[model samples]
Target: MAKLTDMEELASKIIDKNVQSYMREALTCYMTGAYRATIVLSYIALFDDILAKLDVLAKVNKKAKKIYDEVSKKRGNQEVFESDLINQLSSNNLLTSLDSTFLDILRQLRNKAAHPSGHKPSAEEARFIYFESINRFLSKEILSTTQLADEILASTVNKNLFPSTDITTIAKVVRKELENIHPDTYPYLISKLIEKVPSSDGIVSKNTSFFITGLTFDNNDERIVSVVRRMLIEKKSQDEDYFTMIIRSITSNPIVLETVDDVTFKRLKVIIQERISEVDSTLEHSRFSHPVSMFSSMCGVLNDEVISNNFETEFSSAIEKFLYSSYLLNNLSKSEYAKEKYIEILMSKAGSSDFEVANKFARTCYTIIDELDVILTDQNAFKLIVNLLRAASWNAFGAKDLRNAKFQSMPAIRDKARALDLNDKSEAKKIYKEVFGTDTDYENLMGKYVR
Candidate 1:
């Protein structure tokens, strides 16, 4: 055991030193394959060195009794380390599929890197793994530390999507917004936004990314960068119309707002409606120059051949505008449905063929369903989802034939629809069974209203 302990300690130090050397020599002005190979080998050496020492501790290598006494049994607390990482991630309480994938990949590699003789990864392979792992680990931390971007996104009610932007302002927004997320979604959403804004390219683009909103730092430190990023968001929010309203009740979010009551979210509805009124006033403004950015751009006539009944034009007029506008989305959609769509195009576009690289779309749908259910009970939202499912169903077939993607089966669309159905059905069953004895086909009753 003592021999093992000594081995691990020495190995950790060597790994740490080698990593620094590798980074400094391999990257930037010193970029070369030798440096890169050295970096990669350093990572492999970390694991290899540790395992080699442990092997000595084994009966095979001969564990010395006195040496074992000198070594302590407790290494760094694995639970504590993992918990801290998880806590930082969930601090803002939003996780998109991309964020989830980034975490999944990082943790998996970490395990591979830590285990004994874990398949003798090559130097180049080690570098590749390290390359990817570094981003996975740091992306959220970098963004959250930036903090300006989250402020901008959450403050979407007043500002244009790409308002005359700057890195300082972006960092400011991210810092401020982190306090608003419930910590659970923080890591996932933070990862998603940062990954989109390639930090590897340079500091300039990285700084710019924090401004785009939906981004944040992944740590608890309230450093100067964090504070400044927060300051920028608060300042920007203050400049916009209805700033006072959003500022007044930001702590009212259902997903863990500190020092606020649950009822505050209900009051937020009124604030949201007021913001909707504010957006109505901006329609004639000159800034909405992009053709697709217009509030009505994403909206379409719902050719619901099955509905047979016309959607109330009276209601549709107000609702239709709400569906497409980014400003109205956070409020009107009730769930993250609209917000997710906006992110989709922000990251990728139709005919662009750059599918979301980091997140599984289906998993994203599931998460939205889970989070939205906490606050929303609208039947209309469910119907809209059903319509979306239909679209996915049709597109799946076309995609299968055209691109030969394996996920083109009807099952994919059905899975999406079924996620909604299961939630709706379960909710219905509980309510109905509680009210009346037994249940008589719950999905049927719920679908009548939601479908």
Candidate 2:
């Protein structure tokens, strides 16, 4: 329990605190790089339902879906790609309140990513993917539709883009085209564009004030409830007019300091580190009209502040201050369940094909084991087993089954994986039988293991 003095901070911290485990996993996976695609793909396919519920925004909306169908039909046609897609949306009855002009812009990027040799999204794109996917697919109605709109629009403003010298630049071109949607979101879109762009002109000023204003706010509304969406599967480019509008809009409604509850405060702390200079400190901790259960998160992902000044220079001190705050994180880590859960998430991600992120996580876990007690406890030992199993065959199973899978016997699972080194199915099986009862195995591992 939190003491009275720290109640406010604790309240805000709750929101940010819940996901450190997942974030830890993501970070480790990021370092390995081998399991990134698998992790991302599996996450989407597996947790499709959870994501759908939580998602405050849908990816295709009605407009994008219309275009999607048309594009699918004209497999080889390039001349009228946009028209084909638009027609398909009109025909499919997927059309809704969202704008088609924006869908036109989105389709191009989606097509590029889906194309055989087209570019994959960069880290920024990936982050945005996580954000929008969560909003469209998994997020609950934390705010009303009106408030939801406001949060998204307001957040987008902070994610502004600066002027580019090159008018013909692909990213800039993309932005100009997307203005039909919110027009204000262009700056953050530009931020995402730069994140996806390969060594192109950088987006300066991060999630600062340069923003597009006047977009309506979305309070949690029931209109889009229980709807599954895949909002952003690709990243768009930047444009001059869109960029200017975003910058102008945000400057007009500069991000003010937010008076956050504990739940939101931790989130602010985590996000603020990206690029401190651009952070509207006053704005980050402010209170909003949304409910805790259904509020939209990941709004800060595209904040121009992150893309502006170096986060190292901008947010390091603030992060440090938060970490040292009277045994806050220390207490959390000391809890065996929490520590083990964190490790399980991290290690699971580490046991992937992406060697860089995987290895990075493994090393981090090693350090934790050597350094932290809770992470290495008897309870955690079993927890590690469950995590290992989850990691060893993440892509092989349905994500929906994860929640139901028994984990009480993780200790045995861990020992089995290690005894066979996750390489010899026979040895692992033999060990499994010994520990789990039944099953005699010396050969034909998969066949026996399946039994």
Candidate 3:
């Protein structure tokens, strides 16, 4: 909206070399006091920029192709060609009505300036035409190619195109293609991709997710964040799978969390809590893994203080409940990668200074300490033993019975502990004696001590 002060400034905004040439000539004409010539040349530059954009869009868009074909046929007749192009652009939703109106005014000025008329545009009119032309059309990258979104959707099903299972690489390809699209087109593209989520098969669904997540890379545009937030709110209750996909996409790029409003964020917290609570160990691995992954990813986002603290307590409570849930403990023995991953997750929390969470985690581990080989080995096993003793020492009142039950149930746990190197073995024996008020019987460590 700022007024154009210098011709060089106006020319610098233009990207196309052809448009720059026209603007450069217009600047020269304006400097020589040729106001009418400036207005005419600037209009030419604006029209050429529009045509070039339409030509690019025509390759993939029927609307733009039709407009380009119609305008191409009318090229010889300047009056009809310009009028048809502007009216078509406006009607097709490419150019808003206001932009069309501004272009019309510039066209009128150009007509008057080009003709043998007494009317002469002043310097103000010339500069206005120059500035509006660049600001409205030339400098803007308005592809409006919604068809590109369709093509991308189709490409998602093609294995050759998305040959890599790596979501990052696939997302990079998606992001590269999306860079040519106007920001206004993103909402439509995003909605289309989300619409595909609930119904698509695994590969298609995953690729679609990668496509949506790809949009957040290197993009902090509020327009995109607003659209995604609105879609999330709309889809939260309407469709569970759709809601999950959108939320995962947002959390996939945690930076987006920085701009999310508190109300929306609270809703996300509730959804995540519900999902984690819904995790059923009785079901498939994905059922357990999906919610836990969501929980961990959302926790990662909370590291940034920009997110509201109002929901932190609620989220922490959810994390505690999830960490200590009977379902998670049951899942630890399931011979799947999710179990090991969740164990690592538990160990991470247990190793922290949070006594309550660590205690709950340690207590839950009591249910499955005999199944340690299913979840932990080597360093992880040693860490679990160390944490168990640490937690028991912190709350030794009733832990004595529970610890006795665990070691009694799984005497092999002592042999596993004794298998550690001299240093770790010495540390374990030290913590064990401090917690149980007895020395580890190195001669018969696996023997059940009923004290």
Per-model CA lDDT versus the true structure: 0.34, 0.33, 0.63
Root-mean-square deviation of candidate 3: 8.4
Candidate 2, 1-451: lDDT as tens digits:
2222332222232223334234334434444553344235424331333222223233424344334444444544534454453444334432222433434434544455555655765555434433433333223222112322233333433323334322233234333333233323333443443333232323322222222121111212112110100011111102322322222222222231122234433333333333233434343222121111001121232243322222222222432222212222233342333333334444445344454444444434333333333334433343344343334344423221321343222334444334443455554544445433454432343232321
Compute the lDDT for candidate 2: 0.33
Q: On residues 1-451, what C-alpha lDDT tens digit does candidate 3 reach at each position?
A: 3344555776787878778888888888988889998898887778778888989888767888999988987775554688778888888777767788998898888889999888979988988888778766777776454566667777777556665645467667876777667776788877887777665577777777667666664456778766766665444534567666755665555555655666666666676666656756454322312554433444434442432254444445444555544434444443333444456566555444566565555456556565555446544554555455545556643334445565454455544554653447566556445534665543243343221
TM-score of 3: 0.64
| Candidate 1 lDDT score at position 444 | 53
Off by over 4 Å in 3: 4-10, 76-80, 145-166, 169-173, 176-180, 191-211, 217-219, 233-242, 280-289, 295-302, 306-387, 390-451
The local lDDT score (0 to 100) that residue 208 gets in candidate 1 is: 36
Predicted candidate 1 versus true structure: per-residue lDDT over 1-451, tens digit per residue? 1222332332333323544343434233113434334334443433333223332333221222222222222223322233233333334322334544555554455555455644443444445444433333221222122233344333433434334444245445555554434343444444444333333444433333433332322222333223323333222333333232232222111111222233443443343344445554445321222211222222221122211122123123334333233333333233243334443332232122323311233323342343333323333233333333323334533322322332233333334434556766665354445433455644553354333
Residue 150 in model 3: shift from native, Å? 7.3
Error of 3 at 7 (Å): 5.9
Better of 2 and 3 by TM-score: 3
